[model samples]
Target: MKPVSSECAVGIDIGAGSGAKMGLFTREGNLLGESLLPIERYGRSPVVMVGELAGALRDLVKGSGSPPLIGAGVAMPGFACSDGTVRCNNLPFLDHVPFVPMMEQAFGLSVCVVNDADAGGLAEWSHARTELLYWVFGGGWGGAWISADGQVRYPAVDWDGDDDTLHYSNEPGYAIPLSRERMGVELASLGGSWEGFERICMAEREWPGGRLAGPNGRLDCVRAELFVSGNGRWRIFRTLAAADGYDLARLTPEERQALETPSNAGRVIDRLAEQGCPVVRRTDLMFGRALAAAAEFHFRSGPRGNCPDGIAIYVGGKPSRALPWFGPEAESVMRARRLHASLKLSWFSERNLNANLAGAAVLAWNRLKGS
Candidate 1:
């Protein structure tokens, strides 16, 4: 362990299943030390979770020679508020839990909290120092937008859980509605059906906010995530392959096993795309089109030139790694629509750093600098 100075910060990225990832970073955003406290260690109780996290953080700082902490920033999931209370459906134990104040008290340092997506966006800003859109595709699509001046724009702060209350800029996946009619046409072009895709989605969790709404409030659309995230991408591959009469039964045992597993399907689809599989190519193309629509809605809602032409939309999460396949089509469609937002792989990811932890470090650095 090296002796760090006062220009150090602690970042806490709390995830579902009571997992907490803590990192020690220099003011320059370099990760100095890192540790994880999994659910198996802390269980599901919020009190125990915080207590376990506090000890882990203390050890993280102490192991680094206990440098004078600049501050601590938490990248949280769900509707996290400034008062330390959070309404996280994934980590239901966090319901109304005063995480901010508790961590501050536990750590004896200034603390700040933000939504994990916003933290990822902030991490992008930390590296690029430019206005950017940050989208992470996983089970759901989470995103954020940072201004040219490093201010987070339209953050999902203290969301009241109202469908209309969510802005496309912040909650792009959930707020942006992909026109059902347009999607149906696209699916038909590939010999697929809207009903089939919807069936795949409904077989799992029901759509949040109920039936989607389109232009003029008409219920003729679907949530953008249903066609954008990892699961959605997997769904696209399955539905398209099934429609094109590509029988999975013909695949090797390993291939079928990979695609059949929901958690591993997106990677399998990406692998198939890499092999130049027509069905996989078409699947990503469909996803690219969906992204184009969401990007248009996202850029238009923000201030002028915030996402200027050629500015990269820095992305994170596992699915973002496949941007090389789907990105060109997305950028192409966006350009055809006169939108110039370019999609790029996450900067932090390329360096093998967790975006959430990096972003939390950036948040703490910002808080320290602002003071």
Candidate 2:
């Protein structure tokens, strides 16, 4: 832990992993230091986790030297309320916990808690004055809207603490479930889980179809076409997965076992991808379509009205890191809806990876400045 270059604020991102990510960012937006601490080592006890995180943070700050930590912000996987309660379904141990007070007491500094996706949005808003919509496609879908004034405007009014999901009702809907059901057989062969499907998506550069036995003794083959959201909950676009002539019946024992459970599916999918499955491309294309559908719905019936002036769209999270195919598909959907506004798809990288942390740092700094 080298000494940081200047005065900085601390930002933390807590997710489903064994630890939480923390970063030190300057008011100028430079990330001076970053670390991942094993807070989960404290187990499912929220109070214990908070205490451990505080101790670890104290050590990190002390090791950094000189420049004082003026304020701190936390990006947790939950819905943060004005009353300081956090409703985290993924981390159910933290349900109804008073996060801000807990952190503020432990760190002896002002602390603000926000949803991880909102933090990402704030990170984007910090750099640009343009209105934007940011989506995080990771463990579960979540998003935020950034205004021209550089504020992350979340749909707080619609948040139900007991809903048990990270996302709010105002953002784009989750698409993986529908995608799985639509591409059932392809996913089944690949192992029937997102991990397996995502492996194929990343491995193949092209999509090829296969002809397999259909119901009623019909031999149907279809190319992979994604289902898009229409006017309401119904799929706006429909297509067939025309079978290309290929053999899919040969499955290794490992593949069979992988298909037996959701957890094993990813490993199987990875193996299939390594063996060069062509259908991976189709799943990738479908993901792009999902992004498109989400954006369309956001503007059409979002908490905010249509952005006639258009909005920049920032896609973040684990999936966005692996796939760079959301821009075109999202724009295509916007066009199909006859709503043309500038839709920019931001890729995942260092430029945006620490958005939540950066956003949190900015918020903390603002609090210090009494702004």
Candidate 3:
């Protein structure tokens, strides 16, 4: 293993849901510590919130004995310039915010900013075996091709027609119309957003037995029936359930009971199985397929031999939430059933230091040393 440099880099990922997490990654890919903070929406004033966030980070580092700082990497939800000008439609307040300079001045450290999905892809590529990898999250997607020699081929940036070089942008969601079309209706019906679908799906799964309820009372059945009627929602639910292990007969009983108790969206799968749907509970195929599609696109779009091995770094709640139905064994089973490319899911939760942060640190260390 390569030794990390004396300097450290921080990877700050800002989620669209107003949550922020900063990971302090050493050159050896060791996450020294992390801080999660909530963002308050105060009308186009992200600078204030982010400044406060930086202050919190400073306090964390100072309290932890003041390790030497080197550079920082940020992952934001919108298109970002090399200098860190962010234009996130969702974060209207952050549009055109000079976040990089603000943080750099606040922390007295160098800062590098990238799109959130791009950072995820970079983190994933840092651990990937293949040279080329594609990554996607709920709102957007991106790709990165890593050479065996460790050179990263980023999508070109079109800066005033002066910096027109080939850079890889993980804007797959923008390029792939079908992906958005597939989920459009469901997203709208479900309150015109996909922010918490994963949590919602999990709630539906655990409803009758879990803890979510409605105004009338326990809402297991009502929610399930509404989800079933929606095309995208139904498909996503069915696919996830299939990945888990429920059979058709079990699904039917659950669905019937859910009809009586709408909030029972949690048990719809079991009910559907009982009613004779050939569905089985499985991992969230939507997330898996979206990621696979992005990778596939990257593999097929460029020079064939130049394509690098693929990797994916998933940063979210938990594999259980994102990959709820499938366990490690089930991943292979699901792959076999789908007969698609062999894509693997590696969990990189914050709780696990080695799995999540080490690889990126090592990769960064190698990059800085020109290895």
User: Taking the tens digit of each residue's C-alpha lDDT, what string does model 2 give over 1-371?
Assistant: 55555878898888776578888777787776677877546788878888888877877777666367888888877677888778787788888888779888888888888777777777777766568877665434567777777666644432553322323322443311233444454334433343443343334234233322211223331111122221110111111111322344567776665544332344444344456655434434454555554455445643343443366666665445323333465567568777565544453333456666677777677667543
Model 3: lDDT to the true structure: 0.46
Q: How many pairs in model 2 have backbone atoms within 3 A of each other, for residues 3 or more apart or on separate chains, i.e. clashes?
A: 11
- Total clashing pairs for each candidate: 0, 11, 64
lDDT of 1 by residue, 46-65 (tens): 77777888889888878877
Model 2 residue 246 lDDT score: 32
Candidate 2 stretches with Cα past 4 Å from truth are 1-5, 155-158, 161-170, 174-278, 302-309, 341-352
What TM-score does candidate 1 reach? 0.92
- Report lDDT (Cα) of residue 208, candidate 3: 43
Per-residue CA lDDT of model 3 for 1-371, tens digit only, reads: 23334566666776666577766776656566777777653234666776776787786576555666666666666666766677676777787778778877876766656655445545555665445443332322334444445544554222333211223333433332223333433344423333344454554455444543321333331222122122223445543444444444533564555533322343454344344543332223343433343434434556431354333334332221333332233344345444233443434433443232333333335534333
What count of clashes does model 3 give?
64
Per-candidate Cα lDDT values, in order, are 0.80, 0.56, 0.46
User: 367 in model 2: Cα distance from truth in Å?
Assistant: 3.7
Q: Runs in model 3 with CA error above 4 Å?
A: 1-6, 41-44, 139-143, 156-169, 179-298, 301-340, 349-371
Which residue segments of model 1 deviate by more than 4 Å?
A: 207-218, 301-310
Sorting all predicted structures by TM-score, with the top scorer first, yields 1, 2, 3
lDDT of 1: 0.80
